[model samples]
Target: MGLWFLNRPRPIKRTISVILDFLAIPFSLWLAFSLRLGEFYIPPNQQLWIFVLAPVLAIPIFIKSGLYRAIIRYIGMDAIWTIARAVFLYSLIFSVIVLTFNDLAGLVPRTVYAIQAIILMLFVGGSRMIARWLIVKSDHHLWKEVNAVRYIPPVLIYGAGRAGTQAAALMKLSNQMRPVAFIDDNVTLWRQQINGMTVYGVDQLAKLIERFKVRDILLAMPSAGRRRRSEILKLLEHYPVHVRTLPDLMDIAEGRLEVSDIQEVDIADLLGREPVAPINNLLSKNITDKAVMVTGAGGSIGSELCRQIIHLSPSCLVLYEASEINLYQIERELASLALDIPVYSMLGTVLNQQRVEMVCRRFGVNTIYHAAAYKHVPIVERNTNEGIRNNVFGTLHCAQAAIDAEVETFVLISTDKAVRPTNTMGATKRFAELVLQAFAESKTLYNKTRFTMVRFGNVLGSSGSVVPLFRDQIAKGGPVTVTDPEIIRYFMTIPEAAALVIQAGAMGKGGDVFVLDMGEPVKIVDLARRMIHLSGFTIRDNDNPNGDIEIDYTGLRPGEKLYEELLIGDNVSATEHEKIMRAEECVIEWPALVKIIRELELANKHDDCQKARAILLDTIDGFIPQCELSDWLGNDN
Candidate 1:
């Protein structure tokens, strides 16, 4: 009950503080005099009222100094200065009173007044410091007791440089985390001391973890490159301790450093792909001062392309999306950014040939980034006709509209699934690429529109991405699902992919199929285990059935592959950009491709799922359906 009262409200705490100061002032004065005289001294009647009135005089001054407003537990060294200032002023007032009264001046010894003033300063300043210490320590003890943990988890900070030292000093003051030692890659800094904490080499990490019982590692190499950081994370992945990385040097330079700046290791760290600096000229080549339009502008890839395009100083941006909510969301976000560029959100699908042509011509669009398509493999597999219509015919109509509108460039966002595909989604994406190729080579009546296709694998954090799924499953404290142990995927961040797409589109000399260099594919099973371990959860396997998270293998989904390829042929050549590669693949002539497209359109129009599948299988080279029957369309029959 007393504890409850103490914690009731800020006003109660402030009131209690004022009362304590009143009682302490007179006691401090008496103690000061007794200490100065080296005996139990009592003041004479004439000067006695001065010591008694000390509280009345000092309380008002302390209150004015805002002493009671500060939380004792959170008070810093600056509070000591406040206490000293109030005390010094009070001593001066007392001296003035003594000097004004002849009786008081004669009663108090001159040497005693000087000694009392010094002692008074100590009592006043020391009281607050002691109170702060007591409160902080008490709170720490209470928190530890409630947690039932025998010891606060000591964190070992990696990197013994300036950033690491600062992080260690900051973490030491944290009640929940204690900084134990430093682990640096520098051999010369090993065995050195920073703030009295020993710094050890990376070789000693295992021994130090065991010795100090380190529960987590704080990565503070803010200036380290992505390659070096990835190496450190990979090494730490084998350890049982949870890994956290600090914000980059930009954040530190902006004075945003905090305990919360330490974030969990992202999937990008595990991807181990070194980020390449984007070329400015390439990024803004076709976009600067030009009207740009992005179909499916609300989808993951499309939305990111829109974001990147706006920064390139496009004169105007037209967001053409099939989903009203998605279109509104991107439009609202762009509006909130308050960019000078004009933004027009058109609610229509790429399938609407007339609408696509109208939007292109209405905006005088210089470039069209076609990202509209059915991308999810299983969903597309279950809905074959819709997938082909959207992915295949959708690309055909959009490209045709671009040509008619005399657009300067048209870029189709293709996927790795399009390479020697086993899935209808991949086959449709491949067909979209073929459509662009056919258009680029055709004898057209309209102005020649440069048609380009940029193909890459999965992007991290996009819709239907496994990263978010694994994260959600881990957060729920359950069995994380893996499609197959052997399944491997190439992942890139959305921004990087968008940037590459823009650059690749700029390099296109019509009919060019550019494939961005997707770094080494990551195994799905390994990815799941690492995610669980990095999150401070143990994998529950046959040997450790009692562990935290269980890994469940659900087998592959429909139209899914164990691995995906970025290129269809060995005729791949490096471009000026090291990350972007150009591929030369066979393309059907305009006459043949137009005939095939017409048949595909008629088949889709009649809802002939079997005929559509047959056309895709026959038209696309090396295209193989997982099965002969259309299971999803049986109900329509």
Candidate 2:
């Protein structure tokens, strides 16, 4: 019941409002006549017929003034103006009808229209105000029906800006989550009341949290860049309150803002690096008025790149995806962006060199962003053949096709896992990187297309990321599992990773492996502790017996690492930008790498697991056996 009125049913409301509109007309007429005359006189017997026809005749004028369509529940000053117009028209017609009889001709003049209009407005418009009050009363009743909003843990909003105010109003409307107070850093708004709620100072956060029993603090500074937002989040992190943030403003699709727009706070907020706002002209320089093709455009990073690129005013955007559902979803989303840019989706895999080449030739694709890859480390470790086929062979196919088509630029989204790999997944990714490096060098000599790879660490909220897994485990009442107490990983937000990739694509010359500086690594155990505490629970261990939830150490899984590195070798040099660096590393020539690739491909065809493993070992140096080679061939668990 509480949630019901908070988010109402639209169709039922519209029908109810239309009925109230017709009834308010006669009600206002009686109130007007009785008020102006200073007495409650009954209508004359002959005049009853005139009042009946008055409603019928006035219906069109009222509709023309748009009064009939004015919703009582959402009414404001606009509805009042529409009511006034409808009233003047109705009263004028009624008076003119009486004057035709000549009996009351001299009694009422043209001024009666103005008088009746004012009276009708009072009763009809006043009734709407009454209706609004009733609806609000009912809404409030349902909201506090079970006192759910109050029980939802008191929350404080950080900003009082337009977006913050919008978030606050939405919170008021959503009875499930109540914002106890507003906390603005701005001195001008301190202590002032907005929509009847007192605005508190940011300095008063501690006092307010204690007094109000605040259990959550929503960071409403969506427009704040990463640096400012990180500072604000760090200040709030000290208190044991779950923190959430409004997503970046550019991503906010317009409508009356909804509650879903608010996102659970991410660890990337700690990264402290502000995203370089993409210069639209620079982003559009090459893609605008040109045809673009994105291979694996339905995968995590790939799909996002497609979504962002479509806005660059491309003449045509082609999505080449191996997955059916992902392709459909991306296509639908692109259509909704509504830029009127043509989108062509083809069902094809990057491993099929012929298919990839045919599509590039047919579409005349100018730019290609190769994003499809086998990314999950442990999963890829188990399916070694598939990983090598998809990541290495697949990339070879796309790069060849891009070269064949003479595409201007080709960017591959690489990962930190590719740096000095110990597992099959990492080795494949590294091999793929080497393939691009070799291709770029050969291309420079042969004078062909440009190729680049953008390498970065784990992006928050990707399909296989730890954040979502932790959130899900936390959502369920119980022990949150951490792989190891000392395990640490670098994190980057999805958008930030995507943004850097785009910027990297533009800055590089060719075959340059660009590495983004993912700020200081965070311990998995520490992250789990913060999550538990912020979720309004105490971590249980030998230290605190009365704790609510326990954090357990689940021994590391296959191909798991205690720590990860971003650079493979120390020969990395600073690029034009501060965060990006170009790593100079060893690369295998096409002839040498091709032999190993062919042997591996043949081994996979025969399901000869040993030969495949042997080929991988010979191909990538420093390939130490981290988890016993027996596990790779048989069920050794």
User: How close is every model to the real structure, measured as TM-score?
Assistant: 0.76, 0.76
Candidate 2: residue pairs that collide: none
Worst 10 residues of 1 by lDDT: 1-10
As a TM-score, model 2 comes out at 0.76
The lDDT of each candidate is 0.85, 0.76
Range of the 10 consecutive residues with the lowest summed lDDT in candidate 2: 1-10
Clashes of each: 0, 0
lDDT of 1 by residue, 1-637 (tens): 3344336588987786778777777777777778767899877777778877778888888889878877665566688778878877877787787778886776666665566656666765666567666665665566567558556678999988878876765565565578889998778888888877888988898999899888799988878867788888778877788888888778777756778778877778777777799988999998999999999999999999999899889999999999999999999988988889899999998888899999988889999999998899988888888898899989988988898888999999999999999989999999999888987887663356999999999999999999999999998997899988899999898989999999999999999999999988889899898888877678999998888899999988888989899888899999999999999999998889888989999999998888988998898877877754456667532
lDDT of 2 by residue, 87-125 (tens): 777877777786797765554444545665676677667
Candidate 2, lDDT over the whole model: 0.76
lDDT of 1 at 565: 92
Give stretches of model 2 more than 4 Å off.
1-155, 160-174, 187-191, 202-216, 238-240, 245-255, 259-263, 270-273, 443-447, 573-578, 598-622, 635-637
